[model samples]
Target chain A: MNRIVIGRYIPGNSFLYRMDPRTKLIAMILLMVSVFLIQSFIHMLVALLLVALLLVFGGISVKRVYLGLRPLVFLLIFTFLFQVLFNRQGDLLYSLELHYTVLNLSIAMALVIMWGFTKRFLRFRLLYFLATVAGVFLLFHYLPFGIVLGEGTFSVYEQGLSTAFFIMVRLVIIITLSTILTITTKPTDLNLGLESILRPLRILRINAEEIAMIIAISLRYIPTLLDEANKIMLAQASRGVDFQEGKLKDKVIQVVSLLVPMFIISFQRSDDLANAMETRSFVPGQKRTRLHILHWSGLDTTALAFTCAALIGVILLRVVGW
Target chain B: MNMIDIENLSFTYGGKVEALKNVSLCVKKGEWVTILGHNGSGKSTLAKLIVGLLKPQKGTIRVDGVELSERTVHDIRKKVGIVFQNPDNQFVGVTVRDDIAFGLENLRIPREEMIERIEHYAKRVDMYSYLNKEPQALSGGQKQRVAIAGILAMRTEVIIFDEATSMLDPDGRKRILSYMRKLRDDGVTVVTITHDMREAVQSDRIVVLKDGEILKADKSEDVLKDKETLEKSNLELLLPLEVLHGLEHKKSTNEEIKEFLWQLSLNG
Candidate 1:
């Protein structure tokens, strides 16, 4: 079977694809910090606009971002409603009978969040960033962008729109960076780089070799685990396990049933692994050679330099009280 | 000196079922010994015991002069490697190269040495090209070959194959059997536990097992000629018997009548 490309990686050779994973990871961190530092509404708008430009350049579809955010839409709405109703310090748009606090959906907080998302989109690829931009644009166009609903007479549509946009933005940034990292870097190099960066933990007596082994195994097992889960689900479905006919509680139980067989299969695999290792005269704590060696190239250096620059810029902007 | 020595060795599971009883066996260095039996005839149990995977309830098992006990079992295990029947179950590493390196790692071999040994053994098993391929993605034969490489990389002087080829296709089975013969020729003690009569006939010594006991231990010719013993043990015979049965009957041989049975039970 051909390799699966489920995550955000589009499998291309663009500049983003050639960057080191460590660089991409640091860039994500820098972008996240920059999101919180911009104080002026115009600065936030500029950040958002930069994100839009990035989305276009990255060639990611807007629909992908929305799809990534689809699962979080509910939580986004729930949080938005909670924030607007409970945050009573702002100018009262409406008052709820349940409490003396005025429901002030703070426009500043909402706009800051939106601005934060725009910066994220700029940092990553286009697919999800575009989706989020479209979702938020449509949301602001319809919903009285900053209207707070009282408890007795809340606008579900307004809450949904606000929540969806926030969620879409977060989803777009995380998915974009994550996908970009995975696509740009092989699993082996990524783990090795992570191990090298984490070498300071050697003071705690942590074995880097063992940690590397665990990471390699876990990464390798992800697909195997997914395959096993699918098999178990199908097998349970054949046995009349009604996965679709469940409330939240029933669905959880159905999922637990699938875990039983997956655990069994994994345990069996581990036992086999133990024996296979024994046969190979493998001794723990022994030195080993790696067949594939990953070196930091010029591209890696440039990528890291670019990420460092971004971080430094964010710190500078904050110091200047931007 | 015998490479493997088993004297009055008996193994019981959970102190209830006796898997092997009063089993005494000896194999010279580089000898190829095949244990033949029906399912649950204690062949697998004995193989596990020899490799220190299971402790003997009574008596002793020694490999390369080191006794297999709680104290020395670890050392014995390092010297004696066993390939199990299921290729899928025996893979330690996700990929062929990694799996082959597993045993070497356990032995604390240096990184450079492990790499050198992995390359050599993988090449020996003809799996050098698949060193990077996922073990789960390989064919049964390829998987078995990788397993063999995993064991061989450890450089165990005594290797036990516990129905290692049973799950393999005919080609895979043939490939492993030939490899076993080659290993035996290279002065490695090779013990094969199998139900395949054809494989048994090719061994230096054939030990028939039944009901947790050794029924017969002799040269391949002697064991293959015993049709009565084969019938009692629920095993079929192989080779020359099938040809002889066809000649005597002037008709097609009975498909159910095993090849070995044709020699002793053709007219009975």
Candidate 2:
């Protein structure tokens, strides 16, 4: 109940969890590009297959991965319907004769593309070499590979495939890697990493310590903030302030009420934190001790190596026009 | 050495509501002093002043013979740690251990030493098992314990409990008071701002506050026995202490008061 929807990390000791956060971050960027770069259905299908295999290797349960995606199911459906209706120029498979343009390739392509993009990868694994090749295959599958739109040569399938797949791929890549990083790294270690990584910013006179302190304080208050939100939600619900029971406007009003209290709580917490920090000798450049030590082990090195390999392999695949 | 000395201390919030006026007192090193004041009697304000959280408008505060000023506030803070009324609000760390580590981090102690200090203090406060638990999930008593551990972990000589036990249930209050006595016996200078005279009567000294001014400051025995002075401050004198004193004098006229006095004499 205290867990936040964002930055919610579950601690585990799998191979994915042990990777260096920086490596994970970079690999995610590469994976996103590869996922969207493929065009044909065969490529997408293969990509999904690769993702599934990685999910098994990464040791994250499929049930948990699916649960994470549950919240975005509506968005996925909306995107599919959007592509099917707005996409024109493909053979008109089914039209109700009432201001709706539905194309054959759009419907089948949307489902296959969605499935191709979602499988295995949602669970998060290291499959850079195969995934990129599969992505290229998917990229060429629906995009007017050997055909033209008869004259002007505008293929809806090609445009939709490139645009939709790229957008979905980017979104999935960011979300999955972030989840992977958060679930693996303890928050205190994450702060330390941020501090060490941003150390070079000292040359810019950016006051890295101050920025790191803000992030650490914000992270520390996560549970307290969640508790405040839940308390407001329950209090409002008891008073018949039913957000789900009302029209859009009423729901918005209810949400506003909840947000107002949450904001107030956050301000109060921050004030308390500021006072606490100041009293505890939290002066800039003050020497301090840490109770927890994060050790970079052999596992971390191996994970980093794997992540870097995946990233370079994906880029090479792209370079070679695979 | 006097742990803390306050002379003619006065404070106002926004130049309107006066929180404290002409408050003067002294707490010797290792003395357990209780400041008994009801709501708005300026007890907490005094605690804040001693810990350098609030600036005195018209007085001098000296901690360990060093005058408290803006330049010396940090030094005063290192000597005195305050546990605020709301344990939840006063805590800066997510977990009990982390919260204790917060102060150490600010002090910039080495990592190895910080871990040793945290465990030591957490054990003293009997919160060793809860080192990793979040403060919010703890009961009021447990939260207070964590708060104490956090302060004690810093190894400050003087500690101020500003209604630290008020949020607790009866049992929790009892446990905290017991721990406080233990701390006192261990030679830590403790300044507890409380309205609980039962606990106050057991302290080394008691300072009564009324209407933002010091009503009385004396040894607990003398202060607790001064019924007229206490009643004037809207604070009831402690029954047991009064009974024992009355019995010593054999001066009570009321039958119940007489009986209580008589029982005290017999017990003695």
All candidates: CA RMSD (Å): 9.1, 9.4
DockQ of 2: 0.50
lDDT tens per residue, model 1, B113-231? 88999999988989999987875578988988887887788788888998988998899999999999999889998999999998887789999999889999999888887888898
TM-score of each: 0.72, 0.80
- Candidate 1 deviant stretches above 4 angstroms: A1-168, A237-257, A286-289, A292-294, A297-301, B69-78, B105-120, B239-268
Best candidate, TM-score: 2
Off by over 4 Å in 2: A1-6, A17-54, A87-96, A99-158, B237-268
lDDT of the candidates, in the order given: 0.71, 0.73
Best by DockQ: 2
lDDT of 2 by residue, B1-268 (tens): 8989989999999999999998889999999999998888888888877877788889999999999999999988898888877767767776788888888888878888889988998998889999877766788788888878878878889988888888889998998898889989999999999998877866899999987998888999888888888888888756666556566675656886667767766755
- The residue-by-residue lDDT of candidate 1 on A148-178, one tens digit each, is 3432333234344443445445545555455
Q: What's the C-alpha lDDT at position B119 in model 1?
A: 92
